[model samples]
Target: MQRIGSLPSDDSSPGWFHTSRLRQPRPPLIGDAQAPWVVIGGGFTGLAAARQLALNFPNDTVILVEAQQVGFGTSGRNAGFLIDVPHDIGAPDYIGDQANAKNILALNQRGQHILRDLVEQHNIVDAQLRHSGKYQAAIEDKGIAVLNAYRGGLEKLGEKVQLIEGDELKEHIGTSFYRKALFTPGTMLVQPSALVKGLADSLPENVKLYEDTPITAVDYGQKTTLHHPTGRIIADKLILANNAFGQYFGFLQGRMLPIFTYGSLTRPLTAAEQASIGGKDFWGVIPADPFGSTLRRTHDNRILVRNSFSFNPDGRHKPGYTDKVRQSHRLSFERRFPTLTNVEFEHTWGGGLAMTRNGQGFFGQLRENVYGALGCNGLGTVRGTATGTLLANMLAGKNESLTEFLLAAPKPNWNPPEPALSIGVNFTLRTGQARAGLEA
Candidate 1:
């Protein structure tokens, strides 16, 4: 089948995490290389997969290629919530079926443990890793109901969760705007770009990393040959870890929805502005309304706000998208913290996230001699790492229920083409935002 999508240009995101430190250049692939395994993409999933392969087979060569720098894509553009619960953004209620929810929770927990071990082992202090849990806050009565349902869902899975409201919610979040909130002690937070960069920098000796090397074409046969302008990678096996970009390779084409979410970060607050805010030094909050905003306060006193989604099937965003997003973000920030009106956002950017209509994603073989673990929905950090590590283990001949689930999870449902799909998704988003009301 002919490929129908173009490679995304380097993201124009001005992320705070990457800008905080100087970036060391990683050399791109040159000439040609032969390896037993080749993994595409340099995000969390790809990095984790490459790491697993190197760890499992020290004698075998593993090659990893990226179209851009390691964390420059969706991997680095996220708000960095390592959620350990089911967060099905497509569901009528954010939580899905009970059995699947429990299973997904288990998967998330497993992935969290793996990442935590890596963070500790590598001493990834620059990532600003935090074991701090997340707050699911609701502003309106509808939002409160949603939070209640979410808490009930967690209870059904025998998970511990604390539901707070009124003064309790205000005291915890330092905001009277939230009427109710659910605190789950499992979510972890980090500087997304830093974590991915640290992981790439600490890869095993058996793994070769090729940055800024976009594969222009792929010739799949008994062995897959990935062709880049500077070099080619010929490997006995191929693993797709590019998430939504995998659709371009005819891996779950027309199944996953390629949507872009927008985020904006404020410059670090001065001590006066920080005191005006009156909250803790750091906290992360995921909105109770799926369409509402996600907010985070950084350790350095900067605030990050994520809200807004647009359907971009080809992974290309319009030129004026960020301008519009910045206005929305400014409004969101002003509404939440009137005290810090002078604190303006320093950066605004968009990142692609693949959404499945049925809340399921592809995580198995897509073609002969080719394997994939794409579509993290919105929970890419934990789920992507889990799927990538599990993909490596699956290829290394490991089998368990989690392995089976990873290999056999349902693929994304088909979406209509072009303008029709775009219209439908935007309509759904608008309706959700309307329902979200003040929460948005």
Candidate 2:
């Protein structure tokens, strides 16, 4: 069938990952090729699937295609918190049912463990993997209430968490704007784009990676055919890892909402600037309200800020949208760090997040020979990785302990089409931000 969405372009959303060290380029598809399995999209999910497929079926060949370079898409644009707890972005509080909360923790920890091995064995310096816990901070009373509810829920699940209030919270974040915070030890921090690139670079020899190659069309049958600009690929099995773009391909169209979230990274802080806004050298915080801003202090001393969400039905943004987001980022930065008056954001970008109405995703066989995994519901880092790894195992018929739990997890609920979707999503976002107030 003909493709519906465009390839990921770097023109509009240039991020800090692009400014990082140079990487060896991989050529796009140039000729016809046949493989036992073909995976589309080169982000965390696709790379993980390709790696597992190659390792499990060593005798068979696998081809992985990327519309843009690895990490140029959603995988690379995230704020880099690998959360290992319940995080439903649409809800007031992140916690949920006791049994399900435990499952969420186990599933995320499983994904992080796998990623830790890859980072260590491959010596992926770009990942900058750190096992540091994450902080959830709240400025308003409503946000503080959310944190309290979350803490209570975590206690019910028997998860370890530390509550910080007043002076303690200020000392930890170097910001008196927050009145309370919660520290969850299982979460991790990493440089997202680098992690995806490292995984792609360390893939097994049996996997052939093609970058800058966008799939123009795909005809599915007993043998699926993928058509690109320069060539075509025929594989016996197919795995779809393109998250938000899945809607355009007649998969998860009515079941997922493709939301665009914006983030900006500041130029590395000067020595004086760092001292002026001092707390810990590096730290990350998630807002108590899901709609509030997410902040991070990079090891290199740069401050990264993420806030603002819009429903981009087409999965593409007008240039003006990004400029507006940068302005919002600047306002948020100035509000929280008045002491660092001269700080400026060097890069601002937006990425697609596939969210489902029920906070679940598509994670099993959608067709006879086609398996799919996407719709991370805004927790893409750990959720995407865990689901991607499970996709590979499911294809290979490996029923590990977590496989059954994931397979049986709730699926995405159907959503309305354009006019209604546009209206509802925008209204909800605006209402949330309004309620979040300064937290936003």
Best by TM-score: 2
Tens digits of lDDT, candidate 2, 373-397: 8887888777777878888987888
lDDT of each: 0.83, 0.83
lDDT (0-100) at residue 363 of candidate 2?
85
In model 2, which range of ten residues has the least summed lDDT? 88-97
Q: Model 1, 1-440: lDDT tens per residue?
A: 24335786634765754565566748998899999999998988999999999998899999999888887888888998998988665455556677777779888988888888888999988788898899999888888878887777777778889987777666666566777789998899988888888888899999999888988888888998888877777989999998888887877878888888889999898988876657667789999888899999887778999998887777766678899989888988888888878888888999888888876778878888899888878888888898899889888898668888765666688888878877899999879877788887
Model 1, position 359, has a per-residue lDDT of 67
**Residue 67 CA displacement from its true place in model 1, Å:** 0.4
TM-score of 2: 0.97
Tell me the TM-score of model 1: 0.96
- TM-score for each prediction? 0.96, 0.97
Q: Against the true structure, what is every candidate's RMSD?
A: 1.7, 1.5
